[model samples]
Target chain A: MSEDDAVAGPTDDGQLVRVEGFLVRLDLAYEPDGHLWVAPPDGSTGNVRIGLDPLGVETTGTVAHLVVGSVGTRVRRGEPLGSLEAEKFVGPLVAPLTGVIRAVNPALATPRQVVEDPYGTWVAEVLPEAWEEESAQLVRGADRLPAWFADEVRRFRLEGVLAQ
Target chain B: MGPEALLETPARPGSRGSRRAGRTLGTLRVLDFGAVSPVRSQSLWHALACGVGRGSPAALALCRPAQPYVSLGYHRPLADLDLGTCRRRGLPVLRRLVGGGTVYLDPRQLFFQVVVPPDAVPAARSQAVAELLGPARAAFEAAGLPADFDQGELAVAGRKVCGHGAGLVGGAVVVVGNLLERFDAAAAAGVLWAPDAESRRRLAGRMAECVGPDPTWPVDAQAFAEGLVSAYAEAFGVTPEPGGLTPFEERVARRFDRLLGSPAFLCGPGGQSETQLTERRRAEIWTVKVRAGVVEARVVLDSTVLRAALVGGRLRDVVVEDPEGDQDPGVATALEGVTEGSPALEALARGGPSAARAAAAAARLLARARGGGE
Candidate 1:
């Protein structure tokens, strides 16, 4: 485990302590509107790994299949990098960043397995176009994440998409 | 406002509208609810539905499967089927582009596929099921079948009469389901690659009990399909308009139709070769816990031919290879006297002429029970 994967220490105030409902781990970086999370890339490798956020997994039923574009495929922001099929829905795994796909987890056995270990299963690794500039726009750190995730959960609940 | 909303729901067959109104948004295009081959009825609709998610307005298509075919969901394991038997029977086993469990489709089922933009679908999967399937459920009711979309299963009259699956493609949500006029429960059980006959029987029985289509419901395929059009229009608040497939959709569907027809389509790149089935007969022993003592049976297969029939652990009722008749009672008694993994069972395989072959076949049947470990 790298330093980026470290869990935040408990502060005396408890202002932004961990609360789980549509899990928002403080360790991962998230795209604001999309249901995606990215792991910090080490200096040695330029590829940044990405996976579906908890909310994204919960909103889609049993994932039946995962299909990805070929390596070296350049994807525009919001374009489909691949697709995830669930029992009741089939949706594109939209690109969270404008980048060339560096690698996809070739070992991905079954799409349904994502339900068990979502965070650990990185769908693809990409050479980010401008993550340095884009990271600033993402919802990161313990301070802002709780509110953002809670708001999304509430929106989903009201829309009759998520259970209360 | 969506393209369909700004323009009249049906668009009046090329009637002039505002520059912005030309986009598809409010109206739901209705396709002919006619019977088609399994490809056109199932996978083709899926390919078209996914294509519509990109930019076009939402649409619905309904059809009945013209012939028998086994379809697996995008992620379903092909190991769930007896491929050799399917092949021998001229059954085309297809892995559907959509996401769902494996199913057997024949003329008795009416299939409906719906595609809508991402914005139209709720953000939650559960809500989307309720929202999208609500129209289908209402349609079933209109067809004289009370229905509810539970999880991914559609139950009519408290039993599963329909199986539903959905997915998102190209920024759109696609949901598909069927209205069963009748179901071949035994054949469905036989084709599935399950462990023991008990489980397969349970599956068939439970499916019959919970999900199998009602054979008694007077089926009027065309009339039932028309009911769906009306229900969907009301449920989604769209006007049904007579329309045909767009040029782009036709091209996309045609491309995928050919792709879906390929043999490789049934087995993904990572799929294992017809894993458990060996060339010659492989004897496999399968034991299932029933109300009685542990009921064990041996399914002997020489390639696709069923060499022995020891279903439900009753040797008195012996069926030798695709036959439903009685064999010698003395042979059955000898087979029953020997327990699994015993020396007597091994001796039995080499003992008599015909009976000995069956005895040896039982031991080989053990492999299938353990799950295709060829």
Candidate 2:
């Protein structure tokens, strides 16, 4: 499919794009290196929800357990938000933006929902402290996302993470 | 902290090592610490991993524990192990920063840990584990074991020889595995919390079949370390240089030594909360993973008790008992070879109500082992 065809326009809820069978939400800004997404602020709370992107969930294997940072803890960009343990692998979940954790998802107790619905299952909600500065480092916008995402799929495939 | 501060040994004037000093760019530092205390064997590598962004070189660490101990994965539930038994046996239980289930460790196993900057490996966690463990597999093969890397574990002829765990610690990616010269299956099974003697015996039997190297193969610890260093040096396109821990790494190690020994860390993320304890008491079902795709479980419901072993998603060696001391031999025979969640399990209902209840409970136990339910 052409890049334009791969990306669908924004819906009433959000915009989504399909790249190499992996879903990418264009409305959310992403920390490309960490494979995490930050949703726009909630209407009333001004808190942004953060979660693993689809590619992140796929690459990490089936997440068996999760330990998210407790509510009210402050984190700097690139700092550990928490850790995730898959069947064969384990690693940290990095903060996508500088923020204080306003709340942690209850779904972490049983991580099946997080693995099954990466985009929909937010891991934590944060009140971002420096969105204007840090958001520039993130990947967003329809014009930029498709190419970056396609490149990522190609890279993971080359690295033997995805099927050839 | 300059690059010199990170050097294991200070470069001296007119010394033969002088020209090759100062970070030794493109060189893999080899830290060969002979046998160490059980806790140091783990904390040393963790310290190096934490130093990745702070000028720690790409390195390999080799050591064996001077004493036997039991280790739990970072996220594993503390209830998986029987602390009372461990204490009675004088075995120290530790929790590692890496991920995997609980494992029994001792001096017979030689540990090799590779720590590198995260960018040096694939961003994909599975791919990273496989790539990092490639050299260990090679080392095993060089020892004439015909080792294979299957899904992040090293096995010989379908029996696992190397149990591996990997994770990102600080700015570094660390993958740790062991070359098992010998494994005491009964001792390994002793640390786990089993419901009774029969279930523990079954677990021991399964562990003997799945883990450890073939006893006939002789493993020389020095030769294995040399082979590992050579393989890693070749893979990373770097020369091997003998080194020691940097000052920064020493501080980190000291800090980790205390943290890893603390009660809070040993309890891990799955510490026994009151709710979990109550739920476990209510369910009275426990499952322990024997290895990849193998699980042994014990379930107690009402007056009935069931002990089962599941290998490769198929039931095996099922034993059921009731208060009346009566168990239909047909229940065991009928469930034999049945895959988990098969309609055949429900078909046991035709045998009798008690048989049906046992079959249903067995199915749930299998489901829990498969990570489908709690």
Candidate 3:
């Protein structure tokens, strides 16, 4: 999955509220990490629009191999959605919500797309039954961006990237 | 019962009931991943350790490292290893969470691990020690493999064929052991303590190392692992459900990645260095055997410059030959009862001072031989 796909942007928190199949945030700028995240233009049931908060990309090192589950398979919330093999080690791609796998980006199978166009690469799109419950766990909007990113960075030692 | 089918408990940091409710537990979950080589074994050990540590359910994994290697306790010093020997022999040195002396492992050996909660038994201390050392004896007895535990050493006949160790973390205990099936004795020899080396060589020479050297034992790797899993499951009455790494375990893996990335934890003692080493190295440990009518003397030398000999069953002589060549007259009486034909002779052959050094350069030799170093 792309860096952009790991945590998409928070457009208008209003639109990003809970949807049935998936959640969509149309117009928010900035995440707790200060990265600008946005949703994809496609209006698919499984794929949600996602973009990274600016600082999110800077904190996490360059993307490596992206491991997405078999497309079109059923998944549960918090299941190992897959993994993002970072430059250092394989980082997890946690499931946002329980749903059936609808689609995944073909670019992930090849290592280059992750590095060349991480923002454009879409990981996996799940059509969730409860979007609000899942999105509630994700950080949305500019104010929450920094803290969310900081917590993860501190916990995973993403600060290793910052040091580099 | 394949490796992929092994079930792992919930990994998302939640109660077991919430994640897995009434999943039909298998009678025996055999995770046969063929023979995973050493490099892969390291990773599997990490993954298994992390899984068990986080209550990710019980599992049995079998793998063989591609090359020969030695793994020391977490706090063991790299200096303890003869790096030149390891490199020349194409062996790698690794550090593991388990506490014990260094071990030599290869594909010829079968690695078995038991991941379970500490409460599996009533008495934690005896239970912890028995889990690895005891089960092997039972399994071998059942399979007619001739196994016994001689003072925590899992020996076949009179020679040790298994080296076991355990690591307790986060309320979960992981016991790992290796069955030396058809390994290179010479290569493996370089990894043992000189004391153990002498013991092994004597035992091998007597053909007493293994009571039944069953080269054609019906128990293959998969069958042996499955038997152990089933034996343990039956003994513990746990119906294992096959599972895989949970999402939370992956998160834990991320945490592990961060931890391993730090050289301090991997390299240094992280503050428990001295305590761990001191605890592991016991002094003047005596394993007595009435059958042999001899007290197996294990003297962990703490200081240098003393030519200490286990003549017969006692400290036969202590000669210190330094700038001040001083011979402790008390040593002759200390060696009073020890005889020439005891196991002490074997220890002397392997670790005792040479005749010339025993008489002339006693102090320097004693100093160098302190700590019973390999």
Candidate 4:
């Protein structure tokens, strides 16, 4: 779909804010570097799924491909999980939680999965070893996301990286 | 990149977030492997880069690629290059683990590699690139060239004199750059994978324009190596200890040699259909030169619509060419929300929660259309 017609659909699982035609998830915690967001550990699995928020995806432009680590690979928080090569920028997909990879999403088989529903397409599901410690380093929930996301949008716009 | 991308600004010294690591590891080891064939030279640096670790001696390498070769970045696609042309031209295609665009390597350019502890490098990529290339920039200036480090490049009068790459290896960082006495611009540009000769000419012309002019021939490679050594030594506060590769390094380099030389590695993931990124698509750019000010932006875009103007750094004015009555109202509202008094353009980069992403994207085109930035 052309990017102009690719607005975010109504989000059912989380609180959504409509920004400039894109639906941004505000309920999840975002990492400091801006590309990653972590949902708090779900009760049954206690695994936090990591994904990209809409604003970050917008700035990165169209992702041509994704290179991610396989399952069971132990990853450190803040280290690179994989590199995303896109038309506009090439950068690392940083991990949010420090732990073993319990699962990786199958949707990312196509690069378009990322463009379609950035927040919905989790790259990896990590079983965080220390949620209290790691989540403390994250900006969680609606209270923190608005300012952070807005600031990021502003930063990206001035950085001249926003996709046209 | 357009002509505005060539405008060189003075380096903001010390802004590159990295300072002299100032760690004295007793002595710096100079691994002056004078010359190797194209493929081996690349492998040699890869081996040394991976060998860098905590307390590892600051190892420096100087070498020349004995023949011409085109090296691709680790994740870049092979489809971006015309390998048939490369084979016909006898330029072996190779890949580097470092990430970036592809480049041409030949015997005339002197290669320099400096490996240091990763902690000594800044966490920010831009800062680290600035900090690590700082020494090389100093060397070029000391050599009586009017040089400065801009981004990851060392520039002389706005043309690139040095191109560089950096990566983490075994908990250390190895930063590399080239000292060029000459470059074959036509040949360098000619190898790109373009369908038509005209496209190649346009691209090659741009690439040649970006590179600094060739230096005088009969250049002193040894003296140039000395300049790099002195700069690196002073940066890290270590003494130079002349040495060759030990048995272990040789063994390691041998492994890298085979691994890097294999057809699978050379072809890389881009060559394989399973791992290939998108085939290259040229953007269709149309510029609308409005008075609103923002300058110099280079983007490999997914959009064919980029209306850029070269203006000084102030983001003021909006021309929403919405002939269609159906264009979203949020876009106009978002543009109107930018307050008059802000320290910089970044302050206007965002809109309220209800703003559309299209507004931001359009504003980016507007901001860049007017040539102004920090």
Candidate 5:
């Protein structure tokens, strides 16, 4: 199928641009802020995944610890999630999609293990039964976050929190 | 007036000569309930949770714990903790409802809780969280402690005396943290179940980096809490009515009874079975290979060792391969469980996992490096 057909929106195909890198789109959802979705393109195996848009990593800085759940565990879309340890924050790991956890990176059990190899330390994998259902609520591949990420960053800046 | 002389209780409404023309924007009441025991931190947290849960504006005075402990955010992993150290030291470990990094607490510290209605201060983002730390710093000044808002942690001369974390519930912003009087640095390092010698080294290095040089002042918890209450009243422009718990607060406490007393929340949730991968897994699995330029570390794990590595970061890269096994039996023996402790994992995380392990492989390694090798 044509790339345009697979994608939900318009493309820059007119330029015939061919970027050299692998890309895997992911649909994400989380709790505390309520339900939302996003399909982020796959980055590297060890590079940090940022929440530039809403559904990305919200807090700034390298991860200090990442504890994911067991594989085959059935998770709801916006459940209590897992846990993430940043330099200054330790937050819960909410589910991005409701599905069976396919895998969790064992490397993350170590402190700052994810920061050392964020891409390599993929926290967990889930085979969502309703990827379409969840993705429909999320921002498309190239769209900005519907939620106020920039505003939140600005608030953090005003409070003297530097972005890492 | 001196910098410390800046603290003065605000005048009550309708009693001041130049009473500013204003209706109650909101009743900004502060509470100086005085010192209880170290256990009061959670009691105060519950009181604040009630106000926050119901979206009420409030603040409280708090104190640091006498014994040291490790606190995790709600839903954090027990595996992240080094249970052996906690067991050895008899230190308590608990999980908090707010979101933030793990923190160590002791008697030398002072704590404060701010429960404001949602949007009390406009941006409720990470930076905003730091802004909230402003009152805490002011409180330190009020109490005659050299404290300031430095990054996310509170510092006195580049060393952190206070660290804070916050969360919102039912439209109430609850921010909490403490000031340090004393810390058991040795015990603090002992909390992690380091997977290997190298990782332990990195952990120690990081702790030292963050801790920096210690302070020279004596920390008084009671005096500190009082000072913070005065500071909060000044910064938020409110009058603190030294008082007891309100009915709503009491109601919420009863509602959250399990939360306050549960072991799961207090000690962090127990690790899942998979989180405790066995030593066989640690021995057989091909772990991540690390090349630190100066050295290299290759680790293999079985299920048991894998679980240990999962608990902490040390052993993930601890197995050594000496091409010439006869090169040095003494050194090899020393490196046997190089990454088996907390400090080792910390060291490996900061420095190279291999280099740290190699350095600790034997007294000969240290001796040779120091020009005293056999």
Candidate 6:
């Protein structure tokens, strides 16, 4: 994707909010501390997809390699679902919600896809064990997302992750 | 405090999380283990990092390995290093719970580790890395080396003087770096899995040019350690307090030491087999970053292999070899000094099919080296 495609703002449906050139999808629930977004569960499969937000990809210099949890493996919120090795940094992929991993993304084969199109490239699909209780802890809704996302962008900028 | 006072202090049970939230301590704990076994050099700080929590004070641990070893990053594939070469040389290949590429370490280098609570540094990885390495740069400067920390690397005169790795380990942020009094470029290159002897030689030459400190400047290990401690104390605005490992940290270190050397851990998460690694070597462009802006790559094309050294995105010492035992000297000469992202393909088209193929492969290899995929 081109730089223009990456920085494209929210759609007319009012799902995304543009924060400092990064499109923050308000429709998805977020684990702000972990910089992960949780898509609403599929009605048929009842599995929620999880991915790193644009901000997370931006902070991690270059996505060298990604090791995601195997399918059927159980994980807890704040525990390592996997690990990401970037150019200068390495860290865990903290699970946003407790659940069993249903599937791992084929995008792991090309980590740059995750960097280029974060929203489109989901990291893993999880069969959330406590959607009602655990998802409540996530930051969601259009009402709260914009301001929170804007603040996050500002925080990253102040922290030198983004250009001032 | 003195060594006697530090050793006399009893280990506090469950004191890892004893500090109150948001409270900054006035002292930086200094654990200076002069020289230790390769595993202990890594495990000591790792244990401290794992034990850090909300109220935990930042600690700086300094040590050097008594023997040489190859340390791989936490998520790095074991295939990155030539395990047989390491084993034959009696060099233990250990993996550290940190992020960075594979490295060959020996007694000539002094290691400095900083373990702090997550909140102590910036949230952004790059920013945090730079902040953590600031004191190391200061220490090098105080030692009369014109050092600067740029893009998360400490360099002297454009050559990387210190190797660094950082990661969020458990409840703490850990940054580990080495003060290179000397670096064995040949040994460093030898440990890497290269497809051929020529490719390994090219890698070693590039490493010799791009990495390590200035040979002329003499570095006193004791003075450098003291400088690093003082630098950290000043940077954090805290007093240096001599301290030894708590019993809890010691136990964790022992566990880590065992984990670091285990065969399962050495294989890494993917359990990359030799067959898979061989396939990857055949199918992909093998590249290693000597330092920022300098890379060495070997690209294997059908019936031909192209090895090139890239300095600042421009090709240098380009070599093309065919399986029929023929070396394309003309193509190698013509391709020299070609910049990446340029029309190298069209330029080499006149040299025939094999040259054109080699140019295309070189371009892709260069792109991969620069972190820009083809």
The best candidate in terms of TM-score: 6
Candidate 6 residue-wise lDDT, A103-146, digit = tens: 99986777898898999999999999999999999889887887
CA lDDT, candidate 1, residue B242: 72
Q: Which candidate has the highest DockQ of all? A: 2
Chain A TM-score of candidate 3 vs. true chain A: 0.57
Worst 10 residues of 3 chain A by lDDT: A17-26
Residue A48 alpha-carbon offset, candidate 6, angstroms: 1.4
Each model's lDDT: 0.60, 0.76, 0.45, 0.58, 0.45, 0.76
lDDT minimum window of 10 residues, candidate 3 chain B: B1-10
Q: How well does candidate 6 score on lDDT at residue B242?
A: 88
User: Candidate 5 chain B: worst 10 consecutive residues by lDDT?
Assistant: B3-12
Q: Report chain A TM-scores, every model.
A: 0.82, 0.90, 0.57, 0.83, 0.53, 0.91
- Name the DockQ score for candidate 5: 0.10
Ranking by TM-score: 6, 2, 1, 4, 5, 3
lDDT of 1 by residue, A1-164 (tens): 23222334444555323333444567778765556788777579878888877777776655546666668888765566775655434445666677888898864545544666677788889889888887776678877677677666665565555666
The TM-score of candidate 6 is 0.89
DockQ of 1: 0.24
What's the true lDDT of residue B359 in model 2?
80
Give the lowest summed-lDDT range of ten residues in model 4 chain B: B2-11
TM-scores of chain B, in order = 0.65, 0.88, 0.60, 0.68, 0.61, 0.88
lDDT, model 2, position B191: 92
On DockQ, the stronger of 4 and 6 is 6
Model 1 residue runs over 4 Å out of place are: A1-16, A19-23, A61-77, A98-130, A133-137, A141-143, B1-25, B195-203, B269-374
Ranking by DockQ: 2, 6, 1, 5, 4, 3
lDDT of 2 by residue, A49-132 (tens): 999888777777778778776688887776667777765556666677898999989887778887788998999999999888
Pairs with steric clashes in candidate 2: none
Candidate 3 off by > 4 Å: A1-164, B1-30, B142-144, B191-223, B247-266, B270-374
